[model samples]
Target: MNRTGAALLLVAGAGVIAVTLALWGQPLVSASGGIRLWVNSIWSPETSQQVADWYSVSHLVQGMLLALLLRALPLRRPDTVLLWSAFAIGVGWELAEHTDFVLDRFRATTLYQGYLGDTVLNAVMDYVFMLAGVALARALPVGASLALVAVLELASSLIARDSLTLSTLQVVAPQQAVADWQDAIRPARP
Candidate 1:
């Protein structure tokens, strides 16, 4: 993508993030310090719903992967292709997260025992985060983009509570050890 296209994506991303914050109107979760650009805790019971938490990283990684995957396809205007894909995937996931079945699935799992659905503001922010990732992938070198994807995946899991890869693994396979580990971090309440 050209500089102009990348700049536009950045502007659009910022606008969406701003709109999300405006819509939130109030902080959903109050951390000890306050809303931050990034929080290290994965499931603090305090900062989970804050502006930037562990699961927030998942959205960005998802966008990077989706953008990369879509770009791989033989399509002209790859950025446009990515834009539509992000819309469909982002909206679909937002709707899915609110569904009873998906919420139950999350509740049954290790990572999200207190698995209430996301707030509308958080949901919107999540979509915008993905857009940021898409823009990053388009603007950065392939190696740098891949490196970022790697760093995000690792940091989220190691420094926080969950990650895209771990979430997908637990969802698809439901491993005992992973479940045990997650339980160790924040045990499920009765």
Candidate 2:
């Protein structure tokens, strides 16, 4: 399929996913009942309710990594397949993320003590951000993409005291020391 066709398909897929989420009783917006472009505090109740948050950075990185992975593989038309694959993965994660199993895991292990799943808007925007990442990876040099990933990772870590890497480690391993450090370093919630 052509690029525009593939993009439209992904948008349709996102629409279906959004409707499914609504049916599953997920809110289209935060409990605050507002539509925000960005929410600065990751610790706030509005964290995953808005269009963008710190975790959105991780999603963007996810796209870059997925695109790079597909490019490395001996697959035909990787560019054509990249968007669909990334959208499927993102939707899958968003669906699973709202499940009791994943939510419990995050609450038990990560700094997301009060963690709830993303709002529909946030979830959909995440896919968009990932697509942006895919475009970015295709546009920039390999070294540049990697450098951007490094910068984003470091910036998220320093700013939030938790990042995609740390969150993944916490879920997969759950080191007590790291959890304690995260709790200690977490800024006072508003």
lDDT of each: 0.70, 0.81
Q: Which stretches of candidate 1 lie over 4 Å from their true place?
A: 1-39, 187-190
* lDDT measured at residue 148 in model 1 versus the true structure, 0 to 100: 94
Summing lDDT over every window of 10 consecutive residues in candidate 2, give the lowest-scoring window. Answer: 181-190
Instruction: Compare the candidates by TM-score and give the number of the best one.
Output: 2
How far is 81's C-alpha from truth in model 2 (Å)?
A: 2.4
What would the per-residue lDDT of candidate 2 be over residues 1-190, giving only the tens digit for each residue?
Answer: 6878877867876797688788888888888888988777666678888999888998888888888878778978776677678777877887888889998998887577878788889888887787788888878888899899889889987887667888898988898887887677656755
Model 1, position 94, has a per-residue lDDT of 62
lDDT of 1 by residue, 1-190 (tens): 5667655655555455445544645344453545556656666664445566677789899988887887678997876767767766776676666677877887777667776665444666677787778878878887888999999898877766468998988877788887777667663556
Clashing residue pairs in candidate 2 are none
